[model samples]
Every structure is written in C-alpha cells, then in structure tokens.
Target: MRVTQMLIPTLREVPAEADTISHQLLLRSGMVRKVAAGIYTLLPLGNRVVKKIENIVREEMDRAGGVELQLPIVQPAELWRQSGRWDVYGPEMYRLQDRHGRDFCLGPTHEEIITSLFSQEVNSYRQLPLLLYQIHNKYRDERRPRFGLLRGREFIMKDLYSFDKDEESLEISYRKMYDAYNRIFSRCSLDFRAVEADSGAIGGDVSHEFMVIADTGEDAINFCSECDYAANMEKTPCHIHEKELVEEEGPLELVATPEARTVQDVASDLQVNTEQVLKSLFYNVDGKLVVVLVRGDRLVNETKVINYLGANRLDTADSEEMLNNFGIPMGFAGPVGLREKTAVTILGDLEVKCLFNAVAGANKTGYHYINVNPQRDYQVDHYGDFRVAEEGDPCPCCGAPLQVQRGIEVGHIFKLGTKYSEAMGATILDEHGKEIPVIMGCYGIGVTRTMAAAVEQSNDENGIIWPAAISPFDVLIMAVNQRDELQAEFALNLYQKLKRAGIDVLYDDRQERPGVKFKDADLIGYPVRIVIGKKAISEGLVELKWRATGELIFKEKDKIIAYLQENLTAMKSSKR
Candidate 1:
C-alpha cells in the first residue's frame, strides 16, 4: 500500500484518554480512533492487524478439527432462560425488547444458543464429538472499560465449543483446544503463560487463562519458584506457614481506642503487630449479611467468597444499612455482640481461627477488645481460606515462595462439562439407548485484545514492533526522497520484487521528507525495512534494517529479495 493512497493518520501527540502504551500508541499511530468511551473505530492499519490475528486463530482452530459456523449475536431471552442464565448473567448483558415485546439480548457469549442448537440437531451417539467455532464481535457493558481494545464493550472474539460423549472424551477435546490455544498465541509472538484460573460466571470446575506478560496488565498471576505450578492470584491456593499460638493465652480486655478506626491506626496506636489484629469486613452476599475475619495485612478475595457461597453476586454491606439496621458502623464492625443479630453469619479465615489473643473491634465507636481469642471471644460459623494470595507465600503444590507477575488475559479455555447441556437438556442417545447430556468444553481468544497485547509486549518507545506473522505488512520499502529518481526507481523495483516473491510489502511512495517517512515506518513497526537511498542506489545496493533488533545490513539490489526470503523462513520456523 502506498502511503499517499492508504489511510495511515500518524499523529505527533498522544491523546489524553490513552492510558496504557498500546492505547496511546494505537491512537497516536492512527491505527484506531475512539468511537465512544470503550468503543473504537478500527482504521485501516488496526483492521489489518486484527484480521491477521483472527486468521491465526482460524488456522489453529481448523487444524484442531473445528468446523467454522457463525452464531447469532442477538439471542432470545427464552433461550437464556432455558439455560438458567437469564437472571444470572447480570448487568453486563445488553438487554432489549423488540417491538412485539419479546425480550432479547446482545450476546456476550453464545453458550446457551450453541447448546440449544446442538440439542435439537445432534441426537445420536454417531455424532459423539463435534468441534465448532466462530469469529465475531462480543458485547459486554463494562462498568469501567479502559485500555483501548483490551476492555472494549464491543470487541472481536474467536469462540470455540466442543461436544463429547463422556468425561474421558471431553478431556481429549479440552486438550486439543488447549494445544491449539498455545499455537495460536505462539504464532502471534506473544510472551505469555497459561495459568489455572477460576471459572467465574462461566460455571465450570476447571479453567485456564492465557495471559500475556506486560507491566501495564490488569491481571495478577502467581507462579511458583520451584515447580510448574502457576495460577491466577484469586485462584492460587496458599499453604499458610503456621506460627505458634501465644502459649499463655492472655485475658480479653476492652480498651478505649479513642479514634482508632483503620487496622493500621489501631495497630500503631496500641503498639501491636498488624498480624495480631483481626480485621473484620461486613458484606451483603446475595442478600445475606456475613461477617468475615482476616489478618490485618491480608486482603479479602471477593471471588473466593462468591464461589464459596455459590452466590451470583457479592457486595460490601452499605455503610448506612450497617449502621441503621444492625447498629454496626462501617469501620467498627466485628463479631462481638453480633450474636444478637442472628441474621449475620460469621466466616473466618483458617488462620484467623487459630490466632490467639488477637485484637478486634468492640462493635462500638472508639472502643476495641485486646487479647481477643477466636473461639472464646467471638463465634465463627465456618473456617476457610478467604484472603488473597500474596507474594512470598508458599505455593500449594511446592513449598516455595510464589512470584507475582502482571499479565493481560488474551484467551481462556474451560472444561464446562454438562453445565450448559444439562441446563438446556442438550442430550444425545448412547449406544445402549440411554440418553445422556452432552459434555462440553469452551475456548475463546480475544482477537483484538491479542493484537493490543502484542503491541503491549513487543513495542518500544518508537512504536509497535509487530511480529512477522501478525504484522500488517511483512516489509516496508521506502525511498530517501520520492522525488529522487534513482532512489524511487530502486525502491519501486524492490517493492515489486518482494510482492512477486509472496511477501506482504508496504511501499511508501509519497512525496514526503526522509525523516517523516522513516519516523512513520518505525511507528508502524513492520518487521523488516528496506531503504533505497541516493548512495545505495548509485552503488546498486540497498540498506535493510531490522525493526526489532535495530541491526542494519546492506545488500545488492539483485540479492536483497533472496536475503529477505531466507530471513522470513527462519522467522516462521522459530514460531513453530
């Protein structure tokens, strides 16, 4: 594509709303433009990048035996009701009523629709296993969408679903999808890891997220230093190092804390270790008021609480409701005196239960109970792990300290089993004539997010350093000055030669300054750049520069095509 003919709206300044590097650069580089807050219009460059990423996902899925088929983006509410997700899918789904007053929703996912299709079509054991996939736009009304394509409400996605006869057959299907995911990301040249993750609202027992490592990522991952154990921080299991309880348990005594409200304030004012303070948090979990206790230094993982209770939603208790209904102030809530409020259930962390002589609130203003023991001082309805896993905590599998990493999730695969099929009654007849629900597995790749993540991990200060497989173009041919006859002739010849050799080449033939052309070339981040200068053209040679490595080599005009072909072969082999 010629620079003069194509729409590469390069910008010299960054926009105010662009926060992350990918977001800032894509906008400044003219790859994308904002349509709304989390929505964007993909310009020519951005569209090309997204298409390349989608093609990679398509190739890998097809190789894994997936048949391509498109599903409806707008689904009937009746279908969701059959899967019991109509009310469960919360506010993220965009719901609407047609003119006839039938409820419908823009699909954030297609599980219910796909399952309903399978239930009606496949009813025999002969079609025991099936792999189907589609690439399309997904909708989600993100409460606070940011980071450009990373969290857009309307974004391109590749979703694949598998149907199998039994658990063993489902395992095979899951493995195939997992292997395909690895190849898809690998082909995109992403620096990523596949970590075990919670199945969130997808309602599965096992899941894994493919995360691209970046400093600006939103997801936190915990990896063991000594083993292959890796998982999302919210899902990582902790082996709490047991500390000996105070052998001589001290007596519980109430003291005037004056104005100590926060855990830090109370710990510092009383001159006690923060670990000795039991921080209490009141929550309204699915309409049930629950009290939770954790170490002062630890944080509550709300996902663990939500999954543990099997509730669709979890929220903190309203400050006004707590004070008005239970006479418990926000910062002063504790288990003590809550026995009178029988509606409130108390759940404590496993370590909190064994703590002795801990400090807790008196459930009143400016008062606290010191040397407070768990069983004697306060009652706990249950004991379990409720705190977020932190760095330096021992891994559940290996007793080594966990290393925390920041990563952007690009893909996820789940062993959904019969969650959707059973709910929707999607069953097939067995060989013995017995009917059974179809076992399922789901796989998804955020195509646009993967492209943005590639920019996140691979770019430098200049611009995006795209990989050869997923770059908008493999090579960029530019002349020092389009008006210079020798330089222009050499550049045009090289461009045509590379194109004939099956290389995707971008020819910059605009009458622009050499500096501007070079800057734009670097910003676009084509893998290989071939420069035709007055000196090289006179010498029958051209200069080749590596966008990623910043290495420059000079080759004769006749042999440069051969050199590029050889380099491209090596690049393809390395991705494999």
Candidate 2:
C-alpha cells in the first residue's frame, strides 16, 4: 500500500479528549476516530489490525472444534424474559420498540439466543458437543464509558458457546477453549495471566479472565508468590487463620472519642494499632440493611458478600441513609449494640472474632466502647471470610504471600454449567433416553479491547509497538528523499519485491520530508522499517530499523528481502 493513496492522518498534537495512552496514540496515529462518546470509527490501519487479531482468534476457535455462525444482533425481549434476564440486564441493555410495538434489544451477549436456537433445532444427544462461534459486534449502553476501546459501548467481540450432553463432555469443551485462549493471547504477544474471576451477570460458577498486565489497568489481580494460584482481586479467597485470643475479656465501657470518625482517627485517639479497632460497615443487601465487621486494616470484598448472601444487588449504606432509615450513626457504628439497636444481621469476618477487648464504636456520635469482645459484648449472626485479599495475604492454594498487579481484562472463559440451557429449556436426550438440560460453556475475546490492550502492554513514547502478528503492515518501505531518483527507484523496487514475496509492506512514496515520514512511521508502528537513504544509493545497502527494539542495521540491498521474510515469519509465530 502507498502512503500517498492512504488516509494516514497522523497528528502531531494529542487530542484533548483522549484519556488513556492507547486512546491518545490511536487517535494521533490515525488508526481510529471517536464517532460518539463510547463509539468509534476504525480507519484503514485500525481495521487491518482488528482483522488480523480476529483471524488469530478465529483460527484458535476453529482448532478447538468451533463452528462459525452468525446470530442476530437484534434479539427479542421474549428470549431474555424466558431466561429471566430481561430486567436483570436493566439499563445496560439497548432496548427499543418496533413498529408493531414488539420490544427488542441489541444483544450485549448471545447466551439466551444461542440456547433458544439449540432447543428448537437440536433434541437428540447425537447433536451434542456443538461449539458455535462468531466474530460480531456487541452492544452495551454503558452508564459512563471511558478508557477508549477498553470500555466502549459498541465493540467487536468473538464469542463462542459450547453445548454438551453431560458435565463430562462439557469439561472437554472447556479445556479445549482454555488451551485455545492461551494460544491466542500468546500469538498476539500479550503479557497476560489467566486468573480466576467472577462471572457476574454471565451467571457462571467458574470463570477465568485473561488479563493483560498494565499500569493503567482498572482491575487488580493477586498472584501467589510461590505457586501458580492467581485470581482477580474480587475472586481471590481470604482464608481464615484464627488466632486464639490471649488477653482476657473485660467489661465494655463507653468513652468519649470526640472528632474521631475514621478507623485511623479512632486508632490514633485510642493510641492502638488499627488492627485492634473493629470496623463496622453497613450495606443495603437486596433492600435489607446488614452490618459487616472486619478489622480496621481490611476492606470489604463486596463480591464475596454478594456471593455468600446470594443477593442480586449490594450497595454500601452511607451515614445519611443509616441515620434516616435505621436510626444508626454512620461514622460511629459498631456491632456491640447493633442487633439490639436496629436488629440488622451482623456478618462478621473471622479475623474480627480473634480480637480480645477490641475497641469499637458505641453506635453513638463522639463515643466508643473499649474492651469490646466478640461473644462477650456483641453477637455475630454469621462468621465467614468477608475481607478483600491484599498483598501478603496467604494464598488459598499454597499458603504463600500474595502479590498484587493491575491488568486489563481482554478475554474470559466461563464454565456455564446448565444456567442458560436450563433457563431456556434447551434439553437433550441422553443415551439412556432421559431428557436433561445441556451443559454449557462460554468463551469470549474482546476484539477491540485486545487491540487497545496490546498498545497498553507494549508501547513507548515513540508510539504503539504492535505485536508482529497483528501489526497493520509487517514492513514499512520509505525513501528519505523522494526527489533522489536512486533512493526513490530503490524504495519502489524493494516495495514491489516485498509485495511479490507475500509481505504486507507499506511504501511511503509521498513527496514529504524525511522527518515527517519517520515520525509517522513510528507512530503507525509497523514492526519492521526499511529506509532507502544515502546508504542504499551509495553502498548498495538499506537502513533497516525494528520498531520494537529500536535496532538499526545496514543491510545489503540484495539480502534485505530474504532477511525480512525469515525474520517476520519467526516474529509472528513466536510464543509468549
């Protein structure tokens, strides 16, 4: 492709609206442009990169026994209602009404539609073990879309749904997808980890997210220092290590703690460690108020709380809400008289029970109770692991201290069991002739998000260092001086040769300054660059530069093509 013929609107100044590095570089590189708040239009270069990534995902899915098919983007409300997710998705789903007043929605996911299709088309177990997949657009009306492609409302995705007759068969399909996802990300040259994750509205008991490690990532992941155990922060289990209380319990006494509202403030006023202070937090769990107690140093893992209570929604109760509704003090709330005061269920962390004569709020402003023991002064309706996993926390698998890192979620695989199949009545007959809901598994790769994540994981100030396998063009052929007949002739000839040799090469034949071309080339981030400068004209050598390593070498003109052919091939096939 020739640069003069292409719409490569490389920008010198960063756009003001671009927040993330990927978003800024994408706009400046002329790869994509914002069409709306959460929508974008992919230019030629961006489209090429997306297509290449899709090809890699498609190949992997096919190798895993997936059959490619397209499902309707506009899904009927009845399908979602049958699966009991019509209101569950709520405002996130893009809903509309047709001329006939029939309700429809742009699908944020295809579980309901695919399961419904299976129920009507396949009945016998012979048709089981089906893996249907498609690379298509998904729609979600994000309440606050930011971070460019990372959290876009409209984006491309490759989702594969597996159907099997039994749990054993489902395991096979799940393993296939798991292995395939590993290869796909590896091929894309992503520095990622497959961590245990919550399925959320997807409705699965077991799931794993392929996260690309980046400093700007929104998700925190905890990985064991001594083992392979890694999980999303929300999913990492906090194992209870009960410590026997050594101090004897004493009578609880209320004392003046004026102006000490926060945990740190209370600990400072009492001249004790934060761990000696009990932290009481109120939450509205499915319309009921509940008090959760943890050590002052620990934070509430709301995901764990939601899973434990089997609640649809969980939100923190502020001081005003507690005061107005339950007649409880917000900043000075405690479990000692919480049950008697409001009769709200107290969900206590196991670590809290280990404290002896702990200091706690008196549920009254400007007052605290010292020598507050768990069973002696207060009662816990339930004791469980309710704290967030942090650095140095013991790993559930190996007891090693955990390490924390930030990562962007690019892909997720779920062992859906029979959630969708049962809800939609998608059943299959077993060899024993008994009708049973089909076991399911779902795998998805965020096509656009993965492209953006690649930039997030691997980039420098120069521009985006795209993986060789997914770069828009494998090599860039440009002349330092178009007016120089020797350089132009050589660059044009080399471009033709590279094209003939089956290399995706871009030729900068425009009448532009060498500096501008160089900056644009680096910004666009072609993996390999070939410069036809004085060296090519005088010494029969070309200047070769690698975008990733910034390595520049003088190569003989005759051997340049051969070197690139072998080098590019290896770069694309290299595993992570």
Candidate 3:
C-alpha cells in the first residue's frame, strides 16, 4: 500500500483524552477513531492488524479441532431467560425492545445461544464432545470504559464452547482448549501466563486467565516465582505467620484511648504491634448485620468473607445502619461482650483467634480494650482465611516465596460443568438411553484487547513495536525524498520486488521530508524498515533497520528482500 493513497494521518501532538500509550499512539497514528465513550472505528491500519490477529487465532483454533461458526450479535431475551441469566447478569447486559416490542439483548456472551442451539440439534451422546467457535462483535454496557480497547462497551471477541456428555469428557475438552489458548498467545508473541482465576458469576469449579504483564492492567496477580503457581488476588490464598503465644493472665480492661480511632493509632498508644490489634467491620449480608474480624496488619478479602457466609451478596454497612444496629460509631464498633441477642453473625480470622491479648474497640468513643483475648473476653462462631495475600508471603503450593506482578488478562478458559446446560435444560441421551445434562466449557480471547495489550507489552518510548507475525505490514519501504524522481523510482522498484516475493510491504511514496518519514516509520514500528535514500542509491545499496533492536545495516539493493525473508523465517522457527 502507498502512503499517499492510504489514510495514514500521523499527528505531531498527542491528544489530551488518551491517557495510555496504546490509546494515544493508535489515535495519533490514525489507526482508530473514537465514535462514542467505549466504541471506536478502526481505520485501515488498525483493521489490518486486527485481521492479522484474527487469522492467527483462527489457525490455532483450527489446529485444536475447533469448527468455526457465525452467531448472531443480537439474541432473543428468551434464550437468556432460559439460561437464568436474564435477571442474574444485571446491568452489564444491554437489553432493548425490538420493533415488535419483544425484548432482546446485544450478546455480552454466547453461552445461552450456544447451549440452546445444541439442545435443539444434538440428541445422542455419540455427537458429544463438539467444539464450536466464532469471532464476532460483542457488546456490554460498561459503566466506566477506560484504557481504550482494554475496557470497551463494544468490541471484537473470539469465543468457543465445548459440549460433552460427562465430567471426564469435559476435562479432556477443557485441556484441549487450554492448550489452544497457550499456542494462540505464544504465536502472537505475547509474554503471558495462565493463572488460576475465580469463575465469578459464570459458575465454574476451575478457571484460568491468560495474563500479559503490564503496569496499566486492572487485575492484580499474586504469583510464586519459584514454582508454577499463580492466582488472581481476589482468589489468592493468604498464609499467615503463626506467632507463639505468651502465657499470661490479665483481666480484660477498657482504657481511655482518647480519640484513637484507627488500628495503628490505638496500637501506637498501647505500645503493641499492629498484629496485636483486632479490626472489626460490619457488613450487611441479606439485611442482617455481620461483624468480620481480622488482624490490623492484614486487609480483608471480601469475596472470601462472602463465600464463608454462604451469601449471594454483601456490602459494608453504612454509618447510619451501624449506629442503628450496635449504637456505636463506625470506627469504634467491636465484637467484644456482644451477646447472642444481637442479630449479628461473628466471623473471626485465624490470626485473630490465635492472638494472646489484642487491643479492640471499646464500643465507646475515645476508649479501647488493651488486654482483650478471644475466648477469654469474646467468642466467635467460626474462623477461616479472610485476608488478602501480600507480597513476600509464603506460597500456598510449595511454600516458596511469593511475588506480585501486574498483568492484562488477554484470554480465559473455564470448566463450566453443567452451569448453563442444566440451568437451560440442555440434556442429551446416553448410549443406554438415559437422559443427562451436557457438561460444558467456555473459552474466550479479547481480540482487540490482545492487540492493545501487545502494544502495551511490546513498545518503546517512540511507539509500538509489533511482532512480525501480527504486524500490519511485515516490511516498511520508505523513499527518503519522494520528490526526487530517482529516489521515487528506486523505492517503487524495491516495493514491487518485495511484493512479488510474497512480502507484505508498505511503500512510503508520500512527498515528505526525511526526518518526518523516519519519525513516522519508527512511530508506526513495522518490524523491518528499508530506506532508499540518496547516499544509499549512489552506493547501489539501501539501509535496513530492525525496529526491535535498532540495528542498522547497509545491504545490496538485490539482496534486501532475501535478508528480510530469511530473518523472518528464522525468527518464526526459533519461536517453535
């Protein structure tokens, strides 16, 4: 493609609204244009890159025996209702009325549609273990869609679903999909890991997310550098250091703390470690107040607390609710000496129960208890892990040291055993003519998000350095002075030669200065750049520069094409 004929509007100034490097470079390089808050129009350059990624994904999916199919973006509300997600999905689903006044939704996912389709067609267990996939547009009503394509209301996605007759077959299908995901990301030149993840509302026993390490990512991952164990912070297990107790008997006494509200302040006044402090928080779980206790040094993991309570939903009690329930302010609430008359369920952390004498809130302002020990002063109904895992903590798997790394989730695979199939009544007949629900697995890759994440993970201060496999153009050919007829003729000849050799070439034939062309070339970051300038033309040679290594070499004009082809082939072979 020639630059003059294409819409490559390179910008000199960055847009104010773009906070991330990918977002700024994509817009400034004329790759995409924003149509709405989270919706964007991909220009020619962006579309080409996305198409290349799609092709890579398709190849890997096909290698794993996945058959591709196209599904409707707009699905009937009845399908969701049948899956029992119409009410459960809440506001994230985009629902509207059709012309006939029937309810419909733009699909955020296709579990319901796929399950319903399979139930109607497949009947026997012989037809089980089928994998179906599609690359299409998906929509979700994100309340806050930031970071460009990373979080969008409408974007392209590749989703696949597997159907099996039993749990054993489902495991096999899940492993196939997981291996396919690894191959897909590896081929895309992404530095990623498949970390254990919470299934969330999807309702699954096991799931893993493919994360690419980046600073701008939203999810926090706790991984062990010594072993192959990693998990999302929400689901990561906390390992506490057990402290030996000092045998001493002191009566629990309430002393005047004098305006010490926070745990640190109270611990400081009492001359004790923060671990010797008990922090109490009131939560409203199903309209009942529940007190959650943990050590002052640790932070609460709300999901674990909710799971321990066996509740579907929970929220921190408001100040007014706390005052009305316990007649104490928010900061001064405590679980000491509270009788069973109060409709509050007490949950204490293992660390809190193991403490000898801990300082706790006195239930009165500006006062706290210094010698209060659990079971001696107050009692809790249960004890479990409710603290977030911190850095330098012990690894839950092999007892190795832990490390924290930030990563962008590019793909996820889940073993969704009958979560949707059973709920939607999708059952099939076994060989013995027995009816059983189909076990299912879900796999997804954020197509556009992977593109943005690649740019995020592989870039320099100049711009994005896209990998050769997924670059919009494998080679960039630029004539330093297009105005000069000799330079223009040389560039055109080289462009045709490269194209004839089956190379994807972007010919910069625009009448621009050498500095502007070079800057733009580096900013767009094609894997290899061949420059036809006056000095090189005089020597019957051209300068070749590798974008990733910033290596420059002068090669004969006839040998340039061979050099690029050989280099690309070697890089790909090394990856395998």
On residues 1-576, what C-alpha lDDT tens digit does candidate 1 reach at each position? 777789999898888888899998888888999999889999998999999888888888999999999999999999999988899888989999999999999999999989999999999878868998999999999998999989999999999999999889889989998999988888887889999999998988889999999988999999999999999999997656566775778888888887788999999989998988889998888888888889888898888888878888888889898888878876666777777855787888878977888888888878888888877778888888899999999989978899999999999999998989999999999989999999999999999899899999888889889888888888999998899887888788878888998888999998989899889889989999988887686787789999999999998878877888899767754662
Q: Regarding TM-score, does 2 or 3 come out ahead? A: 2
What are the Cα lDDT values of the candidates? Answer: 0.88, 0.92, 0.87
Model 1 CA deviation exceeding 4 Å by range: 241-244
| TM-score of candidate 3 to 2 decimals | 0.95
Residue 147, model 1, lDDT:
94
- Candidate 1: 10-residue stretch with minimal lDDT: 567-576
TM-score of each: 0.98, 0.98, 0.95
Q: After superposition, how far is residue 477 of candidate 2 from its true place, in Å?
A: 0.8
Report the alpha-carbon TM-score of model 2 versus the true structure: 0.98
Residue-level lDDT tens digits of model 2 in 1-576: 998899988999999999899999999999999999989999999999999999999999989899999999999999999999998887999999999999999999999989999999999999878999999999999999999999999999999999998788988998999899999999999999999999886787889999999989999999999999999999998887688878677878999999999999999999999999999989888888888899999999998888889888888987787888667887788987787777687898889989888899998889999999988788888999899999999999999899999999999999998888899999989899999999999999999999999988778888989899999999999999999998899999999998998989999999999999999989989999999988788889889999999999999878887899899889999975
- Model 2 per-residue lDDT at 241: 64
- Tens digit per residue, CA lDDT, model 3, 17-84: 89998888888777888999899999988999999999989998898889999999999999998878
Pairs clashing within candidate 2: none
Error of 3 at 324 (Å): 4.7
